[model samples]
Target: MGIKSFQGKRDTSQTNKAEEQILVSDYMTTKLITFKAEDSLDDVIALLIKHHISGGPVVNDKNELIGIISETDCIKHISESKYYNMPSDINNTVGNNMVTDVDTIDKNMNIFDAAFKFLASRRRRFPVVDEHGVLLGQLSQKDVLKAALKVKGNTW
Candidate 1:
């Protein structure tokens, strides 16, 4: 007689269900605090504090992302001003200090790939955009964490 197997057949449907891809848009924060290039750095700082956010996207009149402004950037500007013994210039614009070379994520990208990008780039957040490069939302490290938690053992 042939040897009998003890384990039952695996559930292929369950495996497929667990492997269903999660997209960045599913967890990105659409309601973002955006700034204009002409916006005053002081105002940006105040808003960052008010919203308890470390950074935000800089957009144009059409709401297309131009750059990113962060607390670190503001701090650097402030430090330079103090180092040079120059008084804070209220006229300093976000455009002057914001990071222009931004790495953006595709809204339809897989969440796992986004997590890898975050790890490789060491970026706290990435602006999610469409084929037109229109700013759709932002995906932060925390958002990735939330996605991981949601999937948990199902996909991990």
Candidate 2:
């Protein structure tokens, strides 16, 4: 009977964590400073510096989430341009060089799942979007960690 009670308590603890209902929308940053695919690399660099972010999401004309641009990507582009004797202004558009294979999150996803995604990938942040892929907000690993810390634990 003691073993049965202990098992039940363990199951209940795991259930609480799995059933936590904190969604991405609850904590995502809504005031996102987004960028356009047509934005030049110099412009993106300036914006990133101004916003104090390592990267920003690339949106379409309709403000739909498409891709992401990171500082690493920019640095690589600049280095390659210099090494290959290519004009930085030429072929240096975000749309041409930005990472199109972006991993995104839906606003309705739970915080636990978001945490898992962060663990499985090295991405610093994710673009949160609507069903139609519209830019809704941004979710960082720190945001996920913050949400995780809010879940009711066995201790408190």
Candidate 3:
């Protein structure tokens, strides 16, 4: 019998379920925080602070995933930039150093792959991309954690 069929045999479908049926798209956050490559660091920071988000997807004008920007990126820049040499328009430029190369996944990628990527990267979330690598949404650690808890039959 198939896994879903086996799941149907369970007494309580609400709990004791396996993760095989789950995909990143099933739980990924569709409401994404995104920025263009040309957007300023100051602007990105304000968005992050306002939304209380740790990171955002960096996209091209075509809405393709170019990279990601995180609180770490901002902090690293702030700590490393020398005050004496700092440009007056530092807030207007989103420096190359502030963006992280995107490690993206497709909407159909299995949950295991998403979980593995999260475990491997320094990022707690991944930008989901389309077949052509366009930004679609994001899968966060929170989503993965929730799935894990559900599999383990635990309540939040």
Candidate 4:
């Protein structure tokens, strides 16, 4: 006689459910602090401090992303002004100091892939954009950590 099998068949449905992709949009922060290119650095600094944020996206009048401004950039501008003996608070604009070559992530991108991108780029946050490159939201390293924790039992 053939050997009897006591264990039931494995549940493939559960396996499939565990593999569901988690997109960046689900975890990204929709409420963002944005700046304009013409915005004064002094004002930007004040807002950054008031909101306790390290940086923010710079946009145009049409609300399109043009660049990114960070505390590092502000410090750089201050240092340069000091070296030149110029007034740091005068004529400094976000457009002049913001990083134009900004790297963005797709809203539909998988969370794991976004995490990999964060690791590769060494960026604390990534701006999530749409097909037209409109500013939608921002995915931060903390968001990725939260995702990991949520899916730990299923995916990890």
Candidate 5:
């Protein structure tokens, strides 16, 4: 799962030999603003707004990665509340609206795999975890781009 273990995906246009040489840990952001599953949607929303991020990773009692909640998820909650004439801030917990079956990447994974994964999905970021499933950091599509730009032989 380290940088050297990357087996470049042959079919991905965004992947190259250089990207395969980088590890996800090298690019993942460790300073993260996270949320808990038991927190209210309003709480998550306020924090997200304060941070100016679209979403954040959800952790459990042990501070392990559990799910994810995003602006899109919040909008869905708002829409549901509106349709029911309820307030989003009143009684909804992040667990009720978060996507539990989250797609995560191991921190040991390479940039090529990470880039291809992002290319295949609509996710803007992925929660990076260790082999034990503990939260470590976050990998964003932008981070992958930086890896690409930093590759050897590439012009700035």
Candidate 6:
């Protein structure tokens, strides 16, 4: 009877830990890739492909989070414009297509909270910021999975 009670307590403790241990800070990818507003479309595409990332935070010269750019955003622009290999002003085309608004999260936010936001919006990524909304890094479903897999002794 004593052993049974001890086992029950252990199980409860494990459940609580699982529920409480995960936070955004724990799962967020602190090392982030970023883009500038003036960056060319080719530049952004190269960075994304080089890192094999789907998206990243966009920052101003002061490193403040401004927006987010993703493959989806790029495609949206391409489909909307539907003008490839046409003689056009590069600056105007790129400028009009950039995504200028995005959702963000705090580093101290719980991972579950971030997960809920991601699921609700169908957005796979978000920028992680500080108290003043300074860009810290990016958090993605991949980052969360990396953390979770680590916890289970599964290397990412």
- Give the RMSD in angstroms, all C-alphas superposed, for model 3: 6.6
**What does each candidate score in C-alpha RMSD?**
1.7, 4.2, 6.6, 1.9, 10.1, 4.6
**Stretches of model 6 off by over 4 angstroms after superposition:** 1-20, 80-84, 90-95, 150-156
Query: On TM-score, who's better, 4 or 5?
Result: 4
Reference-based TM-score of each model = 0.92, 0.81, 0.74, 0.91, 0.79, 0.74
Winner on lDDT (1 vs 6):
1
Greater-TM-score candidate between 5 and 6? 5
lDDT of 4 by residue, 1-156 (tens): 999888888778778867788999999999999999888898999999999999999987766788999999998987888678997564599988999999999998999999999989999999988887789999999999999888857565
Better of 2 and 5 by lDDT: 5
Candidate 4, TM-score vs. the true structure?
A: 0.91
Indicate the worst ten consecutive residues by lDDT in candidate 6.
86-95
What's the C-alpha lDDT at position 155 in model 1? 72
Alpha-carbon shift of residue 85 in model 3 (angstroms): 6.3
Off by over 4 Å in 5: 1-20, 87-91, 154-156
lDDT of each: 0.90, 0.84, 0.74, 0.90, 0.85, 0.71
Per-residue lDDT over 69-134 for candidate 3, one digit per residue giving the tens place of the 0 to 100 score: 888887766666644567635454554644655677778887767888878886688788888888
User: Ten-residue segment with the worst summed lDDT in candidate 1?
Assistant: 82-91
Clashes of 6: 2
Tens digits of per-residue lDDT for model 1, 90-114? 5378999999999999998999899
- The number of residue pairs in model 5 that clash at the backbone is 1
lDDT of 1: 0.90
Question: lDDT of candidate 5?
Answer: 0.85
Task: Summing lDDT over every window of 10 consecutive residues in candidate 3, give the lowest-scoring window.
Answer: 11-20
Q: State in Å the error of residue 27, model 4.
A: 0.3
Query: Which residue pairs collide, candidate 1?
Result: none
Estimate the lDDT of model 3.
0.74
How accurate locally is residue 36 in candidate 3, as Cα lDDT from 0 to 100?
Answer: 76
